[model samples]
Target: MAERPRTLYDKIWDDHLVHEQEDGACLIYIDRHLVHEVTSPQAFEGLRVSGRKVRSPERTLAVVDHNVPTTDRSKPIEDPESKAQVEQLAINAAEFGVEYYNEHDARQGVVHIVGPEQGFTLPGSTIVCGDSHTSTHGAFGALAHGIGTSEVEHVLATQTLIQKKAANMLVRVDGRLAEGATAKDIILAIIGEIGTAGGTGHVIEYAGEAIRDLSIEGRMTVCNMSIEGGARAGLVAPDEKTYAYLRGRPKAPQGEMFDAACRYWDSLRSDEGAHYDRIITLDAASLPPTLTWGTSPEDVAPITGAVPTPDSVANPAKRAAIARALDYMGLKGGEKLTDIAIDRVFIGSCTNGRIEDLRAAAAMIAGKKVSERVNAMVVPGSGLVKAQAEAEGLDKIFLAAGFEWREPGCSMCLAMNPDRLAPGERCASTSNRNFEGRQGYKGRTHLVSPAMAAAAAIAGHFVDVRSWR
Candidate 1:
């Protein structure tokens, strides 16, 4: 008989599966179902059309972050498209009996942030969301991933998904990251080297030295971008760092149950001499603080690096893509990233709007003022994150530095929130995604780490922030 396999993804996927399909797919039970405004409308409509109730209402959690206004929530949305989306989500949740964190609720924010903060994202379970960033919850040791609309319907009807096993890929980073580098930089460099789709059809198991030293928020950021690399999911092996973060979380077990949970989490690591379908090793010493130069996160370079010229590229396809990015961004090839000025700097999103991220931004800009030319905002990711930052005086620091510190919501990341850039406004932002017109029509976005964003606000360009430290 073959020895049993115990990969982390396998362990969780096998444990929660209620049945196996004829096509080798597993009907895996969903432990947490996070829903936001954009994708839930048709889902709820589907439920109504078929007279199907939510399979497990308690497991299905809803929040209105994407389409709600960030600062002004006094009345209904003025934008016709935005107004209809929010109203539909409310109606859907009410009819289905699923818990809805409305715009006025304290729990309202990005689905990923709300899910973890509410203590619903426990370890040793499966979580699915209609949003791709659902991999953020994998930092808690849960096997989480995004689902399509069809899978969303499946969860509503049966609270399960028919999923095939993803090949396991181990990414081992051996060495502590130097000061000024973050998990963001590490993942950015990895994607830069591996290309965007390097992890297709695989579950990335982040391991080795550098990743172990990352904070939980940092790990969440790293895993949050898993989909950017075309990976099904990304995870860190559970450890002291993971436990310390989850210990006081509302949903984590307490006392003996907690102790037992930790023991099981410890056992989640790859066994001695375990094999992976693929292995990619990273040297932490070689990395530098970086930013994306093109639409894709994979199109990145060092903070001070220059844009690549099309003629400098040998491949015509590559040349065209780079050329298009430069045109849309109003940038030129071989120009220094520092020379690129911006009209705004935004610090908030599911990617970098947590308490720790706020502190990091505050640390960078404390006793300094934002550039007069730069309009900046700091929107928290959750009500809990907002309250915690306020208690710590982080909000005071942000406002003192000329940042408009607003309430929690998705904000400018996905433009599902009211906060968005105007046409032709270039921005240095901590949110992910720099696709053409992502923030607004013809609005250009340059993605960076939170600390880098604060530094850019102070300097009015993509300046290296390590000097401040």
Candidate 2:
């Protein structure tokens, strides 16, 4: 006789369910589809071979990011493979009649960034891309995650995804964050506690006072790394801040329509009595400026801590993994994190390339020079973010601080483009993932927040950002 209580994930899931099978597989409509160069070529080709037109061309948007050069766009792309992928995306987009933003378009950026910037990612929508970081869109209370190339083709042809429901997990962070601690630190801290497989088969909904306090951009940073934590997706309930962030964007509903949308978004939260499959809580104030000393996101320690020894892990397999990671990272057991030097600093990716990230890094490096021993660069998440940073003079501050101001793209986040590390070159990176060869062949990556990456650029090693002047 009573309405059933449901989690945010359940609410969105039920809203999008089109058909359910006996084994629990469902056909769920995809509201927003973000496309990039690397993964969609095959999907697009599948459509061509089958003579399948995109069911909802207007709902799909494509852009070039992963394979675009972060350097001079005035010149033609030099790498043959990169050139082909970029060109093919343009061709595919034209043939399919899907809206596209090319390398030179002002709207061009990492698909994850462009989606939210243009208001294409909306609360209560089901968004998908072929890239792992598609989880980033969940920041707006959407049910979003990455899909495979086959799934991409399926969505392009049908505007629906085959899916199974994921259990709901809650990651609640209480108390205010410490000074110099950021949303990046919060997420890295979470991965440290949960390990890589912690959120397997679940969707994590981040709640509590600390999560509420984060700006939408910060929330995006957290959700962007949900893949690193093994979560199917991550979500935060829509609130006034979420509504405010979407209000003036181009694709968002405007004026009275926006007011009506807000009314629906307001109910996007979990009911008071909803249950979670698992719950994890953290004391935000206790989190320090954290960094990953090994190859995995979970191999994290506070900046003030030391590299963990293999023996510190009780499980033999985990201990062996720790040893392998430390060896790959060029870190010795018990070495202080601050004592490890870095040769490069990368301050961009879908993870930490927003305008706010740029502003934070710029504020930290203002009137200060990057260490002569370290080569550093800043790549904005999108061309729009680049323009915004320049408008606010953040670009000048970074240039004056001796950090290269790179064009927008997924620069140095992976080895896809020209921005990469030489073998054995250690880097302090703001991007997500530090897996073997993530940045380049045998490159060593230490993941940090934008400010911490900037600080490392200046100090040439990890430092307690909380103590930075």
Candidate 3:
């Protein structure tokens, strides 16, 4: 019999399967487990109460990011709850014998960023974290996703998880991207086309000329938002870009071992005739700088467009939802996107906080002052990213441009840290979500690429970045 053709997700899933139940649930072995301060405390406590030892301490890595302050790390964490979460992760990592990166450690950063930076995420492996952005690891061709706290404890005790296989979906973007458009725009466009429930039961595998052209960092940005699209996870097949990114990392295989690893990674792509449950094709060249207008990631439109009217939507429920979102966003129907002035701008997150993202934003705003009406800041994804940005003078450019160059952490991405928006403040942000109060109490977020955010910061309003001079 001929060998069965399989997708990247299928191949990885089968390789990790330990058992299959009649109800369609499967026992899958998790090769990598990433823990962080926010979700691991209760998991560790659970282990302590039950007296269960971590099955594979060496395979797990812990870091502090979500609740860490972005200013003056020397001072103690000001938020009592944040301080407790950070301190508890340290105690848990030590007690469980897991490798840890504390706030003072240079390697410490967002869990997703730290994983790929250290090469702990690899092709053809199952990776899980207690954070939704764990899908970021799938960019390297790993089967990765977020799990609840209970599942986190389960994985710690057994190094395995119970899951039902998700359908395979293909999102292919062909042709060259227009100038000023980026991986962030591509993803935003996808969610806009498919809506939030589009990938609810699927594992989306991104492939095509546009996806292939993206650097590993770009791919990471795309996969990082997979959760916002309502997908189980998203991935890109491992190729030269993936191997090159992993070649010399601290935890990646060395020299001859790396060569052998590359050979295996080469076979991690979907077979030529593999079947997909669904497929979505896009013309990358047609995609413009995209942005989210409403609270949901699905509420997106191109930069050249105007705010949509709720009356334009036929569905009453959807129309009401759009009305509510518009009211909250302080936007009126039919207003030009560029007419929407912003009070703040934030350029950083697991989605766009990489070095490349910083460089792009810096280049766009170099020698230009931020709008006097706008308060803007840039936060690097990791401590290492922060160091690299400073070494290349990216920090100088941002500081000179009137943007705050923050210390590394998940600052402004969510309300877990001090970096946040004031009530009713409208911001052009590069972070993933723009949900109500995601940044702060009643804060309004409009998701855009780093370059677009930088442009908006300078203009004090949304501008078509492609035409910005």
lDDT of each: 0.85, 0.95, 0.95
Error of 1 at 377 (Å): 0.9
Could you give candidate 3's per-residue lDDT for residues 251-332 as a string of tens digits? 9999999999999989898999999999999999999999999999999999999999999989999999999999999888
What lDDT tens digits, residue by residue, belong to model 2 across residues 1-469?
8889999999999999999999999999999999999999999999999999999999999999998999889999999999999999999999999999999999999999999999999999999999999999999999999999999999999999999999999999999998999999999999999989999999999999999999999999999999899999999999999999999999999999999999999999999989999999999999999999988999899989999999998999989998999889877799999999999999999999999999989878888999989999999999999999999999899999999999999989999999999999999999999999999999999999999999999998888988888
Off by over 4 Å in 1: none
Global Cα RMSD, each model? 1.6, 0.7, 0.7
Pairs of colliding residues, candidate 3: none
Ranking by lDDT: 2, 3, 1
Model 1 C-alpha lDDT per residue in residues 91-141, reported as the tens digit of each score: 888888888988889778888888888778877779999989998888877
The C-alpha stretches of model 3 lying farther than 4 A from their native spots are none
Worst 10 residues of 1 by lDDT: 266-275
Model 2 has an lDDT value of 0.95
- If candidate 3 were superposed on the true structure by all CA atoms, what would the RMSD be? 0.7
lDDT of 2 at 158: 98
Candidate 2 weakest ten by summed lDDT: 324-333
Q: Candidate 1: global Cα-lDDT? A: 0.85
